[model samples]
Target: MREFSEDYLRRTRRGMWDDSREALAPLALESRSRILDVGCGTGELSRVLAAESPSGAEVVGCDADSALLEVAADCVPVVAGDAYELPFPDDAFDLVVCQALLINLPDPEAALAEFARVSSDLVAAVEPNNAAVSVDSSVDAEGDLERRARRAYLDGVETDVALGADARAAFEATPLEVLETRRYDHVRTVEPPYDEGAVVAARRKATGAGLADDRETMLSGGLTEGEYDDLRSEWRQMGRDVVEQMEAREYEREETVPFFVTVGHV
Candidate 1:
C-alpha cells in the first residue's frame, strides 16, 4: 500500500464535505449505529461521518499509520490496524467505509471482503477517477500540462488509482451485495484572495517539488529520463507563469476530481 503525509492528505481533502454531501445519502448515516472508516488517514471523512450521523452513533477510524492515528484521535476514536486485517471482531460495525483508500491497494477486492466481514449491514468506498479529472486555469498551458502529468503518473503507478465507479466490480467479488453508485465531483478552486496554502503551492510548482515527488513513479511508468527532464522543464516554465499570474492577483484555477460513492450491503 502507498503512504501519504499528513500535509498531503489535508491539502487534497480540504473543503471536501464542506460544500455538499448529497452523495453520502446512500450511506444512510442517520440510522447508523456503528461506523468504521478504514484507511482514515487524518480523519477528514471520519469527521464528516461523525458529524452527519446521529449524535450517539459510534464512529471509529482505523489506519496503519500510528502518526496519522494520533492526529485522527483528536476527532474520533481511532485504532492502528491494517485494512486487510481489521483489529475487531466480525460484524463489529454496521457500516464500514473507506475514502480514497481502494485506489492505492493492490487487491481492493480482498479488502472489501474484510470490510464485509466486519460490517453487518453496509460497505462503502469513495474513490476517485483520476483519469476523468478536469482542470481549468487562467494560465492557458496549465490545464494541458496537468493532464499530461496525470496521465504519466497513472500509467506508471502500481495501484488502480483510477478506480472510481468501477468499484462495483470489487464489491461484486465479495460476499456483499452490490448497491447504488453515486457520482460526486470534488472541486478545488483557487482564485482571488489566495490563501496561504495556495501561495505555497505556487512556490512548490516553481521549484517543481510536486513533480519531483512523483519523479520515480513517472519513470517507472515508462517516462524516460530525457522525457522527464523535458517535461519538467516545461512544467517549471508553466509554474513560473502561474506564479506571475498570482503576483498580479489574476490566477484562477478549478480542478474537478470525480469521485464515485459505491455502497454495498453485506
Candidate 2:
C-alpha cells in the first residue's frame, strides 16, 4: 500500500467535509452506535464521522501507520492495524467506512470483505475517479499539462485509482448487499493573497520538484527518458509562469476531484 505524509494528507483533504455532506446520507451516521474509519490518515473523514454521528457514538480510526494514528488520536480513539486484517472483532461497528482508501489498495474487494466482517450494518467507501478530475487555471497551459501528467500517473499506478462509481462491484462481490451510491465533488482552489502552502507549491513547480517525485512512475508508464525530460522542462516553465502570475496576484486555480460514496449493507 502507498503511504502519505501528514502534510500531504492535510493539504489534499483540506475543507473536504466542510461545505455540504448530503452524499453521506447513505451511511446513516446519526443512528450509528459505532463507526470504524479504516485507512484513516490524519483522521480527516474520521473527524467528520464523529461530528455527524450521535454525541455518544464511537468513531474509531484505524491505520497501519502509527505516526498518522498518533495524529488521529487527538480527535478520536485510534488503533494501529492494517486494512486487510483489521484488529477489531466481528460486528464491532455499525458502520465501516474508508475515504480515498480503495483506490490505493491492490485488492479492494478483499478489503471490502474484511470491512463487512467487522460491520454489522453498513459499509461505505469514498473513492475518487482520478481520470474525471477537472482543472481550471488562469494559466491556459496549466490545465492541459496537469491532465497529461495525470494520465501518465494513472496508467503507471498499479491499483485501480479510477474506481469511483464502480466501487459497487467490489461491494457486491463481498457478502454485503449494494445499497446506494452518491457523487461528491471535492474542490480545491488557489486565488489571490496566496497562502504559505500555495506559495510553496508554486516554488516546487518552478523547480519541477513535483514532477520529479513522479519520475519513476512516469517512466514505468512508458514515457521515454527524452520525453520525460521534455515534459519536465515544459512543466518547470509553466511553473515559472505561475510564479510570475502569483507575484501580480493574478494567479487562480480550481481543481475538482469527483468522489463517489458507495454504501452497502451487511
Candidate 3:
C-alpha cells in the first residue's frame, strides 16, 4: 500500500465534503448505529461521518497503519487493523465504508467481501478515477506537460486506478446489493500569492526532483527509464517556465480529480 502523511491526506481530501452531502444522502448516516470506517487514514471522511452520524452512534475509524491511527484517534475511536481481516465479528456494523482506499489495493473485491461480512446494513467506497482527471492552467505548456506526465502516470499505475468508474460493477458481483453511485469532482487550485507548499512544489518541479521521486511508482506502472528521463526533462522545463510566470504573478492552475461514491446494501 502507498504510505501517506497527515499533511498529504489533508491536502488531497480538502473540501471533499463541502458540497458533497447530496451524493451521500442515500447512506442515511443519521440512522446508523455502528459505523466502521475502514482504511480511515487521517480520518478526513471519518470526521464527516462522525458529524453525520446521529446521537450515540458509534463511528469507529479503522486502519492498518498504526502511525495513521494515532492521527485518526484525535477525530474518532480508531482501531489499528487490516482491511482484509477487520478486527470484529460478523454483522458488527450498521454501516461499513472506505474512502480513496480501493484504488490502492490489489484485490478490492476481496476487501468488499470483507466489508459485506462485517456489515448488516450498508457498505460503501469512495475512490478516484485517475483517468478522468482534468488540469487547467494559466500557462498552456503547464497544462500540456501536466497532461503528458499524468497520462504516463495513469498508464503505469499498478493498481486499479480507474476503479472509481467501475466500482459499482465490482460491488454488484459481491453479495451486497448495489444501492447508489455518485461522482464528485474534487477541485484543487493553485493561484496567486502562492503559499510555502506551492512554492516548494514549484521548486521541486524546476529541479526535476518531483519527477525523480516518482521514478519507482512510474516504473511500477510500466514507464521505462528512458521515457522517465525524457519526461523529467520536459517537466523541468515546464517548471522553469512556471517559475518565470510566478515571478510575473501570472501563475494559476486548477486540477480536478473525479471521485465516485458507490454504496451497497450488505
Quick one: ranking by lDDT, best first? Answer: 1, 2, 3
Model 2 regions more than 4 Å off: none
Instruction: Give the alpha carbon lDDT tens digit for every residue of 28-87 in model 3.
Output: 887889899999998888898888776568889999888888988998999988898898
For candidate 2, list the clashing residue pairs, or say none: none
Poorest 10 consecutive residues of model 2 by lDDT?
A: 48-57
The alpha-carbon deviation from the true structure for residue 172 of candidate 2, after best TM-score superposition, in angstroms, is 1.1
Question: Per-residue lDDT for 99-188 in model 1, tens only?
Answer: 999999999999999999999999999999988999999999999999999999998988998899699888888888988988999999
Q: Candidate 1, clashing residue pairs?
A: 156-221
Alpha carbon deviation, residue 26, candidate 2 (Å):
1.5
User: Where does model 1 exceed 4 Å of error?
Assistant: none
For every model shown, what is its TM-score relative to the native structure?
A: 0.98, 0.97, 0.92
* RMSD values, in order shown: 0.8, 1.0, 1.8
Number of colliding residue pairs in model 2: 0
Which predicted model would earn the best lDDT? 1
lDDT of 2 by residue, 188-210 (tens): 88998999999999999999999
